[model samples]
Target: MRTPFFLILDAIIFIDVSGCQWRLLPKEYPK
Candidate 1:
Protein backbone atom coordinates (compact mmCIF):
# COMPACT_ATOMS: atom_id res chain seq x y z
CA MET A 1 0.00 0.00 0.00
CA ARG A 2 0.98 3.66 -0.27
CA THR A 3 1.79 3.82 3.45
CA PRO A 4 4.42 1.10 3.22
CA PHE A 5 6.02 2.76 0.21
CA PHE A 6 6.20 6.09 2.00
CA LEU A 7 7.79 4.45 5.08
CA ILE A 8 10.53 2.97 2.93
CA LEU A 9 11.17 6.30 1.26
CA ASP A 10 11.43 8.02 4.62
CA ALA A 11 14.02 5.51 5.84
CA ILE A 12 16.11 5.96 2.71
CA ILE A 13 16.05 9.73 3.14
CA PHE A 14 17.17 9.44 6.76
CA ILE A 15 20.12 7.24 5.79
CA ASP A 16 21.11 9.55 2.94
CA VAL A 17 21.09 12.60 5.21
CA SER A 18 23.29 10.88 7.80
CA GLY A 19 25.79 9.89 5.13
CA CYS A 20 25.82 13.37 3.61
CA GLN A 21 26.41 14.97 7.00
CA TRP A 22 29.38 12.70 7.64
CA ARG A 23 30.88 13.38 4.22
CA LEU A 24 30.39 17.12 4.58
CA LEU A 25 32.60 17.26 7.69
CA PRO A 26 36.25 18.20 7.21
CA LYS A 27 38.28 15.29 5.86
CA GLU A 28 40.99 15.91 8.43
CA TYR A 29 38.59 15.16 11.27
CA PRO A 30 38.58 11.54 12.46
CA LYS A 31 35.38 9.54 12.21
Candidate 2:
Protein backbone atom coordinates (compact mmCIF):
# COMPACT_ATOMS: atom_id res chain seq x y z
CA MET A 1 0.00 0.00 0.00
CA ARG A 2 1.00 3.58 -0.57
CA THR A 3 1.54 6.07 2.23
CA PRO A 4 -0.92 8.93 2.63
CA PHE A 5 -0.01 12.53 1.80
CA PHE A 6 -0.56 13.80 5.33
CA LEU A 7 1.57 11.04 6.80
CA ILE A 8 4.34 11.82 4.35
CA LEU A 9 4.09 15.52 5.20
CA ASP A 10 4.20 14.77 8.88
CA ALA A 11 7.26 12.61 8.40
CA ILE A 12 8.99 15.37 6.46
CA ILE A 13 8.21 17.96 9.12
CA PHE A 14 9.40 15.58 11.79
CA ILE A 15 12.65 14.99 9.98
CA ASP A 16 13.15 18.70 9.49
CA VAL A 17 12.53 19.49 13.13
CA SER A 18 14.57 16.56 14.42
CA GLY A 19 17.33 17.10 11.88
CA CYS A 20 17.53 13.37 11.25
CA GLN A 21 18.19 11.48 8.04
CA TRP A 22 15.39 10.01 5.93
CA ARG A 23 16.55 6.47 6.75
CA LEU A 24 16.15 7.24 10.44
CA LEU A 25 12.38 7.70 10.12
CA PRO A 26 10.23 5.26 12.07
CA LYS A 27 9.18 2.06 10.33
CA GLU A 28 5.52 3.02 10.50
CA TYR A 29 6.27 5.87 8.08
CA PRO A 30 7.50 5.26 4.54
CA LYS A 31 11.16 5.57 3.70
Candidate 3:
Protein backbone atom coordinates (compact mmCIF):
# COMPACT_ATOMS: atom_id res chain seq x y z
CA MET A 1 0.00 0.00 0.00
CA ARG A 2 1.20 3.51 -0.91
CA THR A 3 1.66 5.47 2.33
CA PRO A 4 1.20 9.24 2.63
CA PHE A 5 4.29 11.45 2.99
CA PHE A 6 2.85 13.42 5.91
CA LEU A 7 1.98 10.25 7.78
CA ILE A 8 5.53 9.05 7.33
CA LEU A 9 6.88 12.40 8.43
CA ASP A 10 4.61 12.40 11.45
CA ALA A 11 5.74 8.90 12.31
CA ILE A 12 9.36 9.97 12.08
CA ILE A 13 8.72 12.97 14.29
CA PHE A 14 6.87 10.81 16.78
CA ILE A 15 9.71 8.31 16.82
CA ASP A 16 12.35 11.02 17.18
CA VAL A 17 10.53 12.62 20.06
CA SER A 18 9.86 9.26 21.69
CA GLY A 19 13.34 7.93 20.88
CA CYS A 20 11.93 4.74 19.42
CA GLN A 21 13.97 2.62 17.00
CA TRP A 22 13.17 2.80 13.31
CA ARG A 23 12.59 -0.94 13.19
CA LEU A 24 10.09 -0.54 16.00
CA LEU A 25 7.78 1.37 13.73
CA PRO A 26 4.63 -0.56 12.86
CA LYS A 27 4.28 -2.21 9.43
CA GLU A 28 1.52 0.23 8.58
CA TYR A 29 3.88 3.20 8.93
CA PRO A 30 6.62 4.17 6.50
CA LYS A 31 9.40 1.75 5.91
Candidate 4:
Protein backbone atom coordinates (compact mmCIF):
# COMPACT_ATOMS: atom_id res chain seq x y z
CA MET A 1 0.00 0.00 0.00
CA ARG A 2 1.06 3.55 -0.65
CA THR A 3 2.04 5.74 2.32
CA PRO A 4 -0.44 8.36 3.48
CA PHE A 5 0.23 12.04 2.82
CA PHE A 6 -0.17 13.08 6.44
CA LEU A 7 2.17 10.32 7.60
CA ILE A 8 4.80 11.53 5.18
CA LEU A 9 4.29 15.06 6.41
CA ASP A 10 4.68 13.92 9.99
CA ALA A 11 7.92 12.21 9.08
CA ILE A 12 9.20 15.38 7.49
CA ILE A 13 8.33 17.46 10.55
CA PHE A 14 9.92 14.87 12.82
CA ILE A 15 13.10 14.95 10.77
CA ASP A 16 13.16 18.73 10.77
CA VAL A 17 12.78 18.93 14.53
CA SER A 18 15.19 16.05 15.23
CA GLY A 19 17.78 17.24 12.69
CA CYS A 20 18.30 13.69 11.52
CA GLN A 21 19.01 12.29 8.05
CA TRP A 22 16.21 10.87 5.91
CA ARG A 23 17.73 7.42 6.09
CA LEU A 24 17.50 7.58 9.85
CA LEU A 25 13.72 7.73 9.87
CA PRO A 26 11.91 4.99 11.81
CA LYS A 27 10.97 1.77 10.01
CA GLU A 28 7.29 2.63 10.26
CA TYR A 29 7.82 5.71 8.06
CA PRO A 30 8.54 5.94 4.35
CA LYS A 31 11.89 7.14 2.99
In model 1, which regions exceed 4 Å deviation?
A: 26-31
| Candidate 2 residue-wise lDDT, 1-31, digit = tens | 5579889999889978566545466664545
* Local accuracy of candidate 4 as per-residue lDDT tens digits, 1-31: 5579988998989978566555466764556
Better of 2 and 3 by lDDT: 2
Write down the worst ten-residue block by lDDT for model 2: 21-30
The predicted structure with the larger lDDT, 1 or 3, is 1
lDDT of each: 0.83, 0.71, 0.70, 0.72
Q: Give residue 2's error in model 1 in angstroms.
A: 6.5
Against the hidden reference, what TM-scores do the models get? Answer: 0.67, 0.50, 0.50, 0.50
The TM-score leader among the candidates is 1
Q: Candidate 3 lDDT, tens digit per residue, 1-31? A: 5569888998889979566555466654645
Q: How close is candidate 2 to the true structure, as a TM-score?
A: 0.50
Error of 4 at 22 (Å): 14
Candidate 4 TM-score, C-alpha based: 0.50
